[model samples]
Target: MNIEVSTANMKFLECFSSETRVRIIELLREQSRNIKGLSEALGIQPPIVTRHIQMLEEAGIIRSELVPATRGMQKLCILQLGEATLNFKRPEETHVPGCHRTVVPVGQYADYQVSPPCGLVSGAKRIGMCDDPRYFGDPERMNARMLWFARGYVEYRIPNYLVRGERPCMLEITTEICSDAPCSTSETPSDITFTVNGRELGTWTCPGEFASPHGKFTPHWWTKTQYGRLKTVRVDGSGTFIDGVRTSGMTIEGLDIRPGAELRLRIASLDTARHSGGVSLFGSGFGNYDQDIEVNLWYDHHNNAETGS
Candidate 1:
């Protein structure tokens, strides 16, 4: 997940600053190793290896477990972090001109139709019960930081902040997501479609759910094996764009987000889609981006602007 350089994460950053520590991390990524094995492989003293292991463990970069050995139990070290990104600026510090933005937490979905292999989790705890559709109705769902479903759609309400004379010229929705492989990781693709205010925008095919390394921000308690990739989908006066490249002929006028109108954003794995794999949406404290579903509206304030509004 994204991390800003600050006092709060100084220890975590420091763990990766040393060459020796980086080597140890690389070794463990290949396979879990005990302290004695690490010392011999790195040609370092056991005490020195222990020190580095302690620091890495404290930073949540690796985890250790006592396992049975020839003579006694040995602490086995395993890499825990799959990836880490250092962000120069905090989320709020980054902004674009002429855009009105709204951030929606994944768990705050206004409406949803999901099947089995679906679940919700807050930053620190599971929302209710996994794979149970009834849990989606729980009030605690509003606090969700992550959600997944094998099929169907999740809809979010986008706040209509446009004033009397403003007209939306562009719309953008971005989030960290991946194919939802129930109980496992897979390279199978999934076709995810997007709709804005009931107007079909376009569909994106997610390559797969990654599990080789754990999500950077995923908590220690989370034992799930899938993580997501960050993606940005945009729809403007011209057409739809995925990660800056135009992918659809549908344009902003089709959305018809008039002044004072309510806006809804829906993401679904349509039954008609070629690849109906599944979907996992990640928000704060759950994915590589450590952010929520971001909706941006670029508007024209001129009363005489040609926007259909």
Candidate 2:
């Protein structure tokens, strides 16, 4: 739902310009409604309502499907947009140099030690039996789009592409994650820790396991968990930050990062944590935001020999 004010997105931006469409968005926000229902509510004919629905659908703001009803079937319109962000600023990469971006699938974890209520699922089907820790080692896990665990940790190794004389300036990792629950409830909270190269970055307490309104990209057949909050963990020269707010004083320098050094990332919900509500990770096909774990490494091409360059 992120967009910029540009001609390229004129269609999406136009969706908000009409009064009927705005009312339609508001109506769908409450719940999915049939075209006839919306037509009656808006005090308009079904033909006009259908036209508005078409606009919204073409703009990717809403979705429509036919369902069984008293007659034959009814066109049901569902709101797909949960949130929208208008970016006024330019992209960071446009101004920053010596930056490397990598996308790692959630199931590609190099190491893991997870407890029960754990399993992996691809976009199509479940990888193995649920609540079985052994399935984490399955070769099919590489195709997994989402995974959850009641306890313990999962680790990933990101290859550093920096060459000699390129000093690591900052590291950022973004992912969609939430507390793990049997199904899903907004009450549970989990203290999740992020570690880079064995150096603790910080701990973020995810509010809950979310399941309402459904994820924009989550498959229809999958119904265990709906979506997760997007989180960004950043480490720079000054400190570590979660979503722009400083969480810890751990700096990038402390990690002993250097050219050609492999970055190991660990996400853990330790048993000793105060709120051990478990963890669930969503990748491309199973979350509101359709993306995998994204890692951005910003560097400076300077001869910082002190950093072992």
Most accurate candidate by TM-score: 2
- Across residues 73-132, which tens digit of lDDT does each residue of candidate 1 receive? 478786766555677787688432367789988988889999878899887888887789
Q: In model 2, where do residues sit more than 4 Å from their true spots?
A: 1-95, 304-309
> What TM-score does structure 2 among the candidates reach?
0.69
**TM-score for each candidate, following the candidate numbering:** 0.67, 0.69
lDDT of 2 by residue, 225-257 (tens): 778777778888889877555688999899888
Question: Alpha-carbon error at 131 in model 2, in Å?
Answer: 0.2
Clashing pairs in 1: none
> Model 1, poorest ten-residue lDDT window?
65-74
Question: What global local distance difference test value does model 1 have?
Answer: 0.79
The best candidate in terms of lDDT = 2
